[model samples]
Target: MSVTETTVSSPLPPGKYYFSGNEALAEGAIAAGCNYYAGYPITPSSEIMERLAARFAGLEGRVFIQMEDELASICSVIGAVWAGAKGMTATSGPGFSLMQEAIGYAALTETPLVLADIQRAGPGTGQATKVASGDLMQAKWGSHGDYQPIALCPWSVQEMYELTITAFNLAETYRVPVFLLGEEAVGHLQERLDIPAANRVARRHYQPGAPPFGHPDPAGVPSMPAFGQGEKLLVTGSTHDEYGFRRTDDPAAHARLVARLNDKILQHRDRIVSTRSYRLEDAEIAIVAYGFTARSAWLAVDELRRAGKKAGLLRLRTIWPFAAAEIAALGSSVRQIFVPVPPADRRPDHLPGNHHPGGTGAVAWPATWKNTCARAPTAPRSVPAAATAS
Candidate 1:
């Protein structure tokens, strides 16, 4: 059968429908006005590319290319973005690793793009089908630079759809790369997705003479000009002046450019970081979590409350530009904090449960947890790891 006819609602219309998280993410990209997609097929994330290809096949002005590898896929997406098209790519852990260099380049150039990472078990090609939130640290620090990235974590199929659109909007607004971090479980889970009739999409503003790489305000986002726009634009990954001239050995220029790239996102973090509180108002204990684990954490909070424990949930919708302020605020009012970490996680510091709230803390894990709480360096003085939910 043709991909268009066989796929689930290619270019889905505005309505409620049953969809997998990966499929919903593809539809969300369409709804967000993404016109270019380049990606390699990697298990859980492959479905997103498949859906986008099916949709692009039936549409005009949209492009889809199955790149030979993740390196080529990310490069193509970057090129498309510079060519004035809303572009994106999807990949899993191994592919994500390969794209780090290009991701750093995109950050230095302030390229606006979206990347969906459906994480699987891994340090290096661990398990393709098994679920794990192992890419949490890699998404933030993998590029090896002072650049800041916006990453959103989705806990359900519906969130996978909504957050994908949010990822595009954030990318365009900040002129930076954005990541939609999903896990194998959520990406493959089937659930209801409600599509709205209209979405508030951000459109990149182009001004002819404005400097594409620098602005007077440290946290300001410069107007982006497309390649064929007759503007004398020079794009480079090296340290550069406001006009994008190469400033290889100029320390001042390098410092200024690097600082702005970070401040633009870090200073405006209030707008980029997103979190949702569940029964936090009167609770004495707070459970902070994100991605797939947040789903179980939410349930655990409800169960704790039923047992006369005043428990609450703080769900992290945005992972990067870490919600430090929110976590601190929640900590001040709570007696203890509980954070659920993925079972048998290979990286300890990358664990979401390691966020130190400056209070007594507990690490929640499933029955299969092989790591101890002591391994978490930033975690607050901890009690024994508790078996919370499966």
Candidate 2:
């Protein structure tokens, strides 16, 4: 069976503790009332599953299972959540790829689940232990349909804990899948994390006997009923009516289903998307970044300021729904905006003044840079200094 009994400690108490991003994510999942964990071990993300495996043991009503693969891992989480349990799973790059189809399935069914992707360098297993922010695009478009995704990028171990809880809350609130995108460097890096005495968690809305598929309001989230709740639920990835009847041949039915899915998040994007500004006020140059690179970029801005340059940092905490308004706001104030990318990314097409392929107009992405906390200042200087000379 998936449930097993063993002697282990209960959930962590409120206090400061040293934790890797993966460990903090496990604790954060617990804090968010996640009682179901299912995943296969993958580098940079295995610790989350391992810790939950130990912690879930002997805890009443909690379940932990080592699934056969990533597909099973995500599918099982979807099942657990529908059974009225808060569920989560963790994985790295390749495993994230495997989970994509199910992610799309979850979106169509409006399943509330949290997925932590501890990112590693890769197109196809390029470097399992190395850090990369390459999955930023995949997290949104990996699935085959036109569904909106909520993705958060945690730059440090502290955020790894807090944002996992936020991810769960957002998922339940919107009745959609949410992603916590963590880079390998931050996932393995140990740092201080403070557990608060109490956290506010959002529970799913359930209106028993009401239709669970379509909402009366176009941008509304429908009430989700658990499997054994006697609601006569008919969940499917195919197009269905508000009463959950299959309507495959009806174009109107398909359009309504698809539009609601996108509208729910689109209308709520302002609240769902999050960003932080460091030294942006009254600055001439701005650097946009996310994930672990944001930490390096923060240091770069500080170094530039010390050298009497007006540099600022805009760190994207939520990536999907793509932070357009924030980037557009920066464009109005800054003379130039630099998005520090890894040296391996040589896409000049992603530069400033070029339309983003994703259609966020003029979203600037620097051509390339070598990133590390120690060498952070070099990247900020290299690009902007050349622009200044011309």
Candidate 3:
């Protein structure tokens, strides 16, 4: 059967189906082969648990656990994954903080798991009800070491559904933790989500009896063996070689293993990174943003274009690995690249510098022609523009 046909859902008899973002995520997970969920209830994310619990109730081999806390939640999910089950968890900012250590462990061990952080304002419990994109940096580097995570940022309810499936595919493909980074507004927003048919869903499976970390493809992503596949698997957080054995004292083993784990995602960035471009072809000014910030930036771009100004939009869908090449190519055509600087907490600081001739402009909302151009370190000079009313 064709790949699309294999995962495509049979057409539903002409009827209407309405779902909230949380429900759509649950449906997406079920379609993506997720059989386990371990998470604690937290604002803006608790509905995901509720929906999954109800959906998985009568399904055999499916497990849902309400752990005592977020840390335990992630820890349990990791154990579930090791037991040969596809596992996941959902949380908001505060709970996400508690789960950081466990997330780091999953990263170190090259565990395939999906984590959804429906973010809220906070360093520690800032604003639970308000919307914010402050977790962008954390999603990429929340864990304490030099590890890479495939992160998907969804702006709307439909994207929330689509990205959940993409997150699982990335997790299984890279054999590493994947994150769905959403803020309060997007996570809680209610909208119509197009649920793809089962056959359209992509499922990742291991070669029967394959070694846990054995690479069957040119990329270092190994064919992941399930826990009960009769393989004597030894999984650990310590630096290990391809054989999945602990080799903490071996410098070469450490370097090789770490590089492979990180490179597996970085090497395939072209296939992984996705963005939405609007009026970018010949525009002189482009606004680069993601999540809710992108929504506003797109609106502003539309308004600017309507006013005969040369404006376009570059909306990011995959936040990690930074999409540097694509951004650089887009920057080459634009005069000024305006990036909506989200609230401090959600900003992606490691994003590569813009290579445009006019440099990068960081714009805060409701301001017009108020550009702050920071030249690259090797560039000739910096240009600052006085704030003008929008």
Candidate 4:
């Protein structure tokens, strides 16, 4: 149901309402002080744009534009961020495919914005309505270069609201484009949404007379200056100095810029990455899952526990900037780590979960997954690994 209907039908206060994941995401963005939005309508994620357009219509200083295409949509979002507005855009797989280059630009320029890839199945628009986590690795590496990705996955409609807000916070904190890696199902699923007060979300601090991309602090994140702020900003996609001066030929400048881009997220991985555990204190076998697939993994883990098996779940709330330390801890505690991956042909070349080793004796289950632990014959296939997740 739409937010307009909730007032008359359900009598909900501003903090509480019933809605779909897509609607909740739009609401979260507004609550996070996102005043700018630009996107092309696409499956699953299009609802975000539609809802935001309606919301922005009645609010001042809020802008929502329906761009001509996906590429233009992402470019506009990054431009909006540089223009001093917290901006976002949403799309499905094919549209997401078009936004990769712009996302890379945002990464190189250290622009703070959010992109929601409410993923559908695809290599090239293969399935418009199908739900899949096929974009997991793409969210990490699709843009290319050595940029660090901060991607979040939401398994349920409620988390859809929560993580959308979290995505904005992380993007602003790191001055990078953070991704909300949701799935088709989550976008359409309906549930109760508990929205925190708008003042609770933090905004990025702007410092005048400071270098835009210069890391004067040890945190690796630099102070951001919005456009027209009289900070003399010169953001670009090429290698540049903190003063926004280009130095593409200077190896040291290139190296420093790239390292800062990577380190800002990696060095703060512990703070950026988040994962949820279920009965994992003493689990013998752990299932690694995220997005829609995680729902089944939780159910299977519950069933395994009922069957007297020490099975647990490690659901990835943050898919990128991989939760290395958390995975390492799971490695020493669990004997086997089973990932409910998509069919072999549909899998991404790399994932944020690939960092762990030694203890995780993981196997990729096929597309024909059931609501239970691995089948009797499901083992030792695709990208061979030794031991378990360590």
- TM value for model 3: 0.85
Off-target runs (Cα >4 Å) in candidate 2 are 1-11, 346-368, 373-390
For candidate 1, the per-residue lDDT at 153 reads 98
Candidate 3: pairs in clash: 6-199, 7-199, 7-200, 7-201, 8-199, 8-200, 9-197, 133-346, 134-345, 134-346
Q: What C-alpha lDDT values do all the predictions have?
A: 0.83, 0.83, 0.73, 0.78
Candidate 3 clashes: the total is 10
Give the root-mean-square deviation of each candidate in angstroms.
6.8, 5.4, 6.0, 5.4
Q: What is the lDDT of residue 319 in candidate 3?
A: 85
Question: Which stretch of 10 consecutive residues in model 3 shows the poorest summed lDDT?
Answer: 381-390
Mark the regions of model 1 whose C-alpha exceeds 4 Å error after superposition. Answer: 1-11, 346-348, 352-390
Q: Model 3, 1-390: lDDT tens per residue?
A: 011213545233222357777777777787777899999999989889998898789667899999999999999899988887889999999898888898889987778899999888777888898777777777877878778888888888878877888888778767788999887877788877665444245445566665566554434777666567677788887877666788879988777767777777878888889999988887977777887667777777777777788888888999886766666676567666666554544233433343212334323232222122122112212222221101
Q: Estimate each model's TM-score.
A: 0.89, 0.91, 0.85, 0.89
lDDT by residue (1-390, candidate 1, tens digit) is 000111223255678899999999998899888999999999879999999999989878999999999999999999999999999999999999999999999999999999999999998999999888888888888998788989999999999988998898899988899999999999999999998767777777667798888888987888898988899679988888889999998888889999999998989899889999999999877878899888877777787788788989999999998887777677667776666677836444555435433322234323333222222223344343221110
Lowest lDDT block of 10, candidate 2: 1-10
Flag regions of model 4 displaced more than 4 Å: 1-16, 197-199, 343-368, 371-386
Task: Put down candidate 4 lDDT per residue, 1-390, tens digits, no spaces.
Answer: 000111111112457678999998888788777899999989978889999999888777999999999999999888888888989999988998899999899999988899999988778877888777788778888887888878999988889877887898888888889999888888999988876544346577676786888785544777777888877678888899989999989999888888888887878788888899998988987777887778888888887788888988999899887766676677677776667754522442344454333323344544455433344224424433234434
lDDT (tens digit, per residue) of candidate 2 on 80-184: 998898999999989999999999999999999999999888888878998877887788889998999999999999999889988988998898999999988
Best candidate (score: TM-score): 2
Name the lDDT value of residue 208 in candidate 3: 65
